[model samples]
Target: MAMMQKTEILIIGAGVIGICAAYYLTEKGYKVTVVDKGEVCSGCSYGNVGVAVPSICGTLASPGIISKSLKWLLDPESPFYIKPRFNRDLIGWLWEFQRACNEPQMRRGLSILHEFNTASVELFKDLAAQEKMDFGFVQKGLLVVFKSLPGFKEGVQEAELRQKIGIEAEIIRGSELRSFAPHLRSGLAGGIYYRRDAHLDPYKFVRRLAEKTRKKGAQILTSTEVIGFEIFGKAIKTVETTRGDFTADEVVLAAGAWSSEMSRYLGLKLPIQAAKGYSITYRLPENYLEMPVSLSETKVFITPLADTLRLGGTLELAGMDLSINKRRVNAILKTVPEYIDINIENLKLIEIWRGLRPCTPDGLPFLGRCRAINNFIVAAGHAMEGISLGPVTGQLVAQVIGNEKPSVDLSLMSIERFN
Candidate 1:
């Protein structure tokens, strides 16, 4: 028999989402306990680019993405790939994703994401300003550079869409682009600058925030994996974990990539697919970049932290696998020289990381209370926007649990929307 503990609120997963949720919930005077399968920030939160950009509007399910993905399917080193599999969930997710690959759905998702990101950016600014909370937060904005004319054209169109949605985007070309990003290679098409974007060291941010949450009377139990849930009449009665059993008044599932599997314990089907992403970190070279840069054509993002520079991108739907694919990693590495004038041959390699990003069919997160389970709330499926929108997602989760109106309208992010 497992020993049982009680808490006012229980949060699963100690990544950015769960830790942020714990931060806000503790702030709201809720007795919170957060548990994770591993140490805090040990998952995707540890190695992401850590960019918080409001200018990112287009989602993975945007129009023409199907065609682009079809083309990428032939190449093993493409930026996006869905591993060949005969799984029913993948098929169902693909079907829904196909339906969402249209103009209207994309626009709707873009609007929601922009709103979430904008609010989260403000929260990040606040968090960075707090005493003893330093995570290398920099608001120098982001530059999306294009090496090809076609890619630049599409980038401009994206800028136009962002402009129409009230996000500030400036399109620069030739000498102007070169001057804006002096480190770029010559003969590049141009770049678009999003002034509202910012970045930080993701690992430092998550770890520091976890420490702060712990100091705020929240119990953070790492190395505790949730194995099963005892549901009693629409409420989770006991959350059985490797450590023991925990009974809370409310439960939150912010387990990132594992949320789908965990939800099955509750007899709920969450249409979240774990999309694997890779990142390589290296020692910061001399005269390093001040702001993050996105290689528009290659889909890679370069972020310079305090002492390290990171190159990260690529989305592979390979289902929870953390194995690094050299071809895909090389695909990201080989594109750096083509876009930037940097010579990475001499740069000291640090670490190569792979993480599974939880993705929904429509590219938006599932972030609300379940209709059938009153005490159950989900804050997962953030896809690539988890870092960008983590704080806002946490605040909203707390609001929902407190029976307060969510700051952002979560109608589209319904937990049971796919049902």
Candidate 2:
């Protein structure tokens, strides 16, 4: 018979969400074990643009998304592209996404998402301060630079919606904007500046976080695959893995893109879909950069690390496959030179990677315990905003374990919303 070693809790996936949950749970004295099919901090959590952007509460599918999506469908090299494939799941997910973009749906999404993201940023600050992790985090603020008056007006509307939810942002145009990032090309018009927003070197951020989590008495398991679940009535009794079988009093399904397949064992089919994203990093000039920024019009993000510069952003609705589309990668790289004078010729491509963002139909993550099961909580499907929501997601998991009220209300993000 296999030795059934019992743990207080078992968390699947070693991504930021999982690690954050482990950090908080262990702090509260829970005997927790986190299992991943692969290495810790080596998944989608690694490849994000690394923004602490609370103001991006407005989802990708917004007021004009239907028309914009139609336009995007026709263009191959657009910022957000949906590659045509005969996969039923992928096609079905797209339809659900379209359905989730209506006015009432988007309004609900913004309300829930903004609250979650704002809480997350605060949690991040507290943990980073206590942990003393140097991840090149800058609270200097974020600027959404635009190249035309129409785009600037659109930026203002976004800022306005963000303001309605208490996100501190302002519309800046002309000389005020030019003075901020003087290197911007002469063809620029204006932008929106979210004063509360922040950025970090994403790769270094995740690497340091994982290392810090491990040093703080949490186990870091790499190259381990969670094969199946050991369900005992309403509770998960064990987490079956390729390496070994271990019992768990509770489990959190923070498995990112793999949550749908993994959740099936529990008789729950999470409508989570994998939205693939790409990013590339290049060398920063020795004596350069006024401030790290994201080009709003181009949808390209640049984060200034301690020494290197990370540029990332590009969403493709392709299924779960690790194959890199060099064409798509090139499509992202083409935008950098349009906004500012950066030496792309001299800088070598330090890294190029893809991550699958676990997306839900309504663009809100499924958080807290489900009505269908007990002791099997879920906290995945943040899509492009996982990094922005990691800390709070973890805190919420810990609160649920402690049987306390979560700092933020998650009723709107309940898994039953889909059902």
Error of 1 at 200 (Å): 0.7
Q: Weakest 10 consecutive residues, lDDT, candidate 2?
A: 283-292
The lDDT values for all models are: 0.92, 0.79
What lDDT, from 0 to 1, does candidate 2 have? 0.79
Colliding residue pairs in candidate 2: 37-224, 37-225, 38-223
On a 0 to 100 scale, what is the lDDT of residue 152 in model 2? 78
What number of clashing residue pairs does each candidate have, in the order they appear? Answer: 0, 3
The residue-by-residue lDDT of candidate 2 on 152-256, one tens digit each, is: 788888788778778888777766766777767666778777777777666566667767766666775767788877677777777778878877777888999
lDDT for each residue of candidate 1 in 1-419, tens digit (9 for 90 to 100): 85689999999999999999999999999999999999999998889998987886457998889999999999998999999989999999999999999999988988889998999989988888874689998999999999889989998998898899899988999668777878999899999899989998989989999999899899999999999999898788999999999999999999999999999999999999999999999999989889999998889999999999999999999988899999999999999999899988899999999999999999999999998988999999989989998999999999999999888899998988888
Model 1, backbone clash pairs (residues 3+ apart or across chains), number: 0
Tell me the spans in candidate 1 whose CA falls farther than 4 Å from its real position.
none
lDDT for residue 60 in candidate 2, whole number 0-100: 71
